[model samples]
Target: MIKFSGRGLLLDIEGTTASVAFVYDVMFPFVRRELDAYLQAAWKTPALEPVLRYIAQDAGADTFAAWTQDDATEQAKQQRVSAEITRLMDNDIKATGLKQLQGLIWKSGFDSGELVAAVFDDVPPALVRWNEAGKDVRIYSSGSVAAQKMFFGHTNHGDLLASFRGHYDTTTGPKKEAASYRVIASDYGCDASEILFLSDIVAELDAAREAGMQTGLCYRVGNAPVENGNGHPGIESFDQVSIG
Candidate 1:
């Protein structure tokens, strides 16, 4: 067990609170299957414009219009964006634009009861325990903030969104960077040492530790094996963590 006398808790989603398989097998496939239909439907809508601009910038273009300069028709531009999204997913690239688009797609699935987040059984009770103990709990994930909200709001164990104080995503900064953890600390309005960050990735934990936050390496089922925890405490479940 690990003991933390911290003001807040920062958590990672995939491979930490939820299984990696569920993301790769269920959520990602859902996005791939629905990508074309969703993109066509959302094109030209207010919500999709910013996301397309981001994707354009990610592709090294100044704007979506510039990116699709060769595409004379709306369908052509949409097809280009679709192709780019597919390429990104094929490589498992975690570009901000791709994540944002995936979140939008996921929102539809979640709202239509086609998708339900699969958090571990220990998660809900632990969230309640941490909240009751007066520790502020938040999430720092690569997924978009909107996706995180939808995910926690529609979990198999019921809505866990109320347990969180805030959410952070790639927009905050790369998870492997110490500066990101520092930014999170500032957002939490507390010293870096007053927050405990947990994740299944040792590099992320190392970054948090570098930022002076306590760190724990989670060992959840279906998570990629971590040969070296880099001296961080290992937690198989939230039950193993005692917050003061």
Candidate 2:
């Protein structure tokens, strides 16, 4: 059984609290398919420029050049940007643009019935129980905070975003890095010992443990470990957890 001694619960998406295949199959494919169109439409949007700048910087291209107006060379730039984006995605950098773009792209798939956010049947009840017990419940995912909101707000489960107290994204830090967990603990204004972090990935749980938080691995049905020698405790359902 997994134990929670914390004053709050910090859960991960795309594997721990949610289905991994849902993200890789539903979310990632949509991003890959519509990325070009999204960039074309959002090139001039004020909120998205920083993400463009990040792309330019990563590609070693000039960031000062105005990308608002597509020129003859725009396609070349987009190709380079696409390549750089692939690298960032492979490395799992929590770029805001990547997350925002994913949210926009996934929006279409979700609306078109191509995809739906998949949460385990037991998640909502456990979340409600956590809330009723006066324990804060938060989300920590590689997905941007906005994307996280959209996923929960429009899941097959329906509008479960209200069950959470807060959301965190890669902006908090790289999920694999221990310092990020420290930052999360600070953000929650609670001792790390009082925070339970649940995830399916051992590396993330290791980082959280280093930050002094408790951890549980949510081995949801149909999901299997991708790595060897993951020694952390694992859970098949939220029903297995005893949260006090």
**Global local distance difference test of model 2:** 0.78
TM-score of each: 0.98, 0.87
Q: Write the per-residue lDDT of candidate 1 for residues 1-244, one digit (tens) a residue.
A: 9999989999999998998999999999999999999988998999999999989999999999999999999999989999999999999988999999999999999999999999999999999999999999999999999999999999999999999999999999999999999999999999999999999999999999999999999999898888988999999999999976
In candidate 1, which residue ranges exceed 4 Å CA deviation?
none
Candidate 2: pairs in clash: 6-194
Local distance difference test, per candidate? 0.95, 0.78
The clash count for each model shown is: 0, 1
Q: Indicate the residue-level lDDT of 15 in model 2.
A: 72
Error of 1 at 194 (Å): 0.6
Per-residue error for 242 in candidate 1, Å, reads 0.9
The alpha-carbon RMSD values of the candidates against the true structure, listed in the order shown, are 0.8, 3.0
